[model samples]
Target: MFVGHYAAAFALKGREKEASLGWLFIATQFVDILFFPFVVWGLETMEFVPGYTETNDFKMEFPFTHSLIGSILWAIAFGGIFFLLFGRKKTSGKSIAFVLGLGVLSHWVADLFVHTPDLPLLHGEPKFGFGLWHNKAATFALEALVLLLGLWYYLKRTVAKNKFGKFVSIGFVLFLLLVNYLNYYVLPANHDIIGLTISALVSYFLFAGLAFWVDTKRT
Candidate 1:
């Protein structure tokens, strides 16, 4: 559910051209961004277990951040903050806020596809997932297909502002694919939760920054 989450961002930005792609990127991963820090703070937790799933080795116990209710609450909070910060100034404020909230909720929905029934309906209620991660090839193909389709829609909705925009946009897509590949096959599993948390936070912010740059380079 890594780069697959960004498909929501791309589709969101394409639908609402006024929404910030950077923020949308953050929104799509907002719960995950919270999940890692929650892990470090002992509010939530996960562990590296070999063969936990076909795609990765992490066994998560993130009720506060990955729960269905928690996700909805976070989305509402995110939308509220956006409304107070910048959405209030625009005529399309409500629409933008809604889209941002949708982006936040999209993370949980995407995770539902690949996760191993770890996502809770509430703090202590039942958990559910489709367990797509159990199949490596299917996971990879599904992520790539969703990302490509979203990117295609985005490109159709917006045009490049210059040569740099055109080239960099393509490069960014390749970079995302490369990262996904590395995550699945190249990167070694780190058992240290703190280190994993730091890495996850860094990667999320870096991708958000890149998405911001890409947005600026386009119309």
Candidate 2:
């Protein structure tokens, strides 16, 4: 659900080409952006428990950020604010609103595929997920395929403006895959939840920044 979330951001740019991919990247991960901070504040919680799932170690208790209702509410707020601030200038506010809202909701959809049934539908239990994370190889393949397909679509829809664009666009995907590998295979076990939360937050912004840079280099 990490880099795979970026697939939504990349695919979205093909349609919302006028919208900033940096912003779209942020939008797709908007929930986790909130989740990390909430974890830091103790408003949400997670614990690193090894062997809980093949790819996920943390048992999460995050309702305010991970719930479907919460996500929709956040999406509405973000889309409303985004449209008022930026969408009004260049495009139809209605379309931008929907796209932005959907961008936010896409996080939940992607998480549904990889996470255990910990994602809540509303306030509490009745959570659901396909739990692809139970199988490491399958999870990796799913994330890689989504990310690669997104990159392919993006490359097809927009031609590189310079050599840097060509190089960085490809590099960006490699970098994300590298990070994914490290997270799944190389990161130290039994890491503190606080440090992990901070790292996750930092990674989100780092990827978003890369998206901004790549967007500027391309169309």
The model with the greatest TM-score is 1
Could you estimate the TM-score for every candidate?
0.96, 0.94
Tens-place lDDT per residue, model 1, 1-219, is 899899999999999999889999999999989988888888887877899888888788987888999999999999999999999989988888999999999999999999998999886658899999999889988898889888888888888999888778668877998999998889887888888888889999999999999999988
Q: lDDT for every model?
A: 0.90, 0.86
> Candidate 2: which pairs clash?
none
List the pairs of residues colliding in candidate 1. none
Kindly report which residue stretches of model 2 are placed more than 4 angstroms away from their true locations once superposed.
Answer: none
How do the residues 181-201 of candidate 2 rate in per-residue lDDT, one tens digit apiece? 887789776467677777888
Give the best candidate by lDDT: 1
lDDT for 200 (candidate 2): 82
lDDT of 2: 0.86
